[model samples]
Target: MSLLLQIETATTSCSVALAKDGVVLGFKQINQRNIHAEVITLFVEELLVSAGLKYDELDAIAVSSGPGSYTGLRIGISTAKGLCFALDKPLIAIETLEAMVYGIINADQSAISADTLLCPMIDARRMEVFTAVFSAGGTKIKPTAAEIIDANSFADLLEINKILFFGDGAEKCREVLGAHRNASFLPDFVNSAVHLTQKALEKFRNKEFEDVAYFEPYYLKDFIAGKKAV
Candidate 1:
């Protein structure tokens, strides 16, 4: 049985999960601002202990490589890389948005129609968001991009397919896209490490691992530092 440790700190959430054969065995998570650095390692230690597993027994470490928070991504990836280096285990990188979509599908499979589109959004500030579109079956239809939301943002796609929008960015988008006939939103959906299990297992089975020393989070846009008030 393959044992994997998954970490997701892409947003305000700091989540960790231990999985065996694509199923979660233990999970610990918290949604708090700027606590990723403090809790990520603790959560990992707690999950392993709770599951009665040792770090050496882990097959690989899976991290949510992101298009989300810059600091959060850096903290998560650095932790995952350190674990891989110390344990001599491979690293599995799961796309943040893809995992979010997977979580949505797993949460309520029956509610999604074959033609329904999945739009996973990570708030990028103001009216812009990091987003991508996926088919109900988990196929990527639109590549990830930082988009400025507006009334006509997804109008063309909405004309042909019903789109399900969720995640932090969706909350602000509802006021703009809510009036559309085919637009549906699930504001309660949140990202978690548990959602990384299936993808991590698949990558492990396929021998797909990131270079421990060189791998980095997928920060889709360049980080722009804000100016401090004098």
Candidate 2:
């Protein structure tokens, strides 16, 4: 059956899903910042129960390896690694931006042939993002980058066709990117584990599983914790 368990906590949302052979059997998600640590395990348990499965039954665990929230990524990676160790299973890390794109790409029947570009962005901080652009066929047009806001950053990238930018960061940067006539935004898009099902299945078949002992989330920048100035 090739059962896979997937987790995504790369942004404000915390999502988990149970799938068999690339088809989701059950899923749960909550879109609130700072809740990944609080809700991830509960959601995982819920999905397992809904799918009538157990931790030991999963063939592998797949997680969104991030260029998104630093704390959120840590919470997810730690939980996933713990399960991997306990269950004696392989772990798969999918890029956060790529997962976001997958969520958008598979959302509709029209998406398969849409000639527009898909640029998925994650809010890294004020005026910054972890983002990349992909063609309708899922080929990367612009490699993921930790970019600062600018009017012309994507000017050249949009010359070919329109782009659909969506994520936590997309709305914030829409105006700045609006100088390019071909650019548009899709604010409804959010990260989800359902998107990782097929991707994880592909990795599982190709033996691209990851070693859990040393695996870590891809926080695009160093995390810095601070308090308000007194």
- Which candidate leads the pack in TM-score? 1
Top lDDT prediction, candidate number: 1
- Across residues 1-230, which tens digit of lDDT does each residue of candidate 2 receive? 68889999998989998889898888999899888988899998888887777889999999999888888888989999999999999999999888877777778748545778888888877889898989887778788899987887787767868888889998989888876788888867878988887788889888898879888888878898878899
List, residue by residue over 139-228, the lDDT tens digit for candidate 1: 999999999999999899999999999998899999999899999999777789999988889999999999998998899999999999
Question: On a 0 to 100 scale, what is the lDDT of residue 96 in model 1?
Answer: 98
User: What C-alpha lDDT do the candidate models reach, one value each?
Assistant: 0.94, 0.86
Q: Count the backbone clashes (under 3 Å) in each candidate.
A: 0, 0
User: Among all windows of ten consecutive residues in candidate 1, which has the lowest summed lDDT?
Assistant: 45-54
TM-score of each: 0.98, 0.95
Candidate 2 scores a C-alpha RMSD against the true structure in Å of 1.4
- Superposed by TM-score, candidate 1 places the C-alpha of residue 167 at a distance from the truth, in angstroms, of 0.6
lDDT of 1 at 110: 100
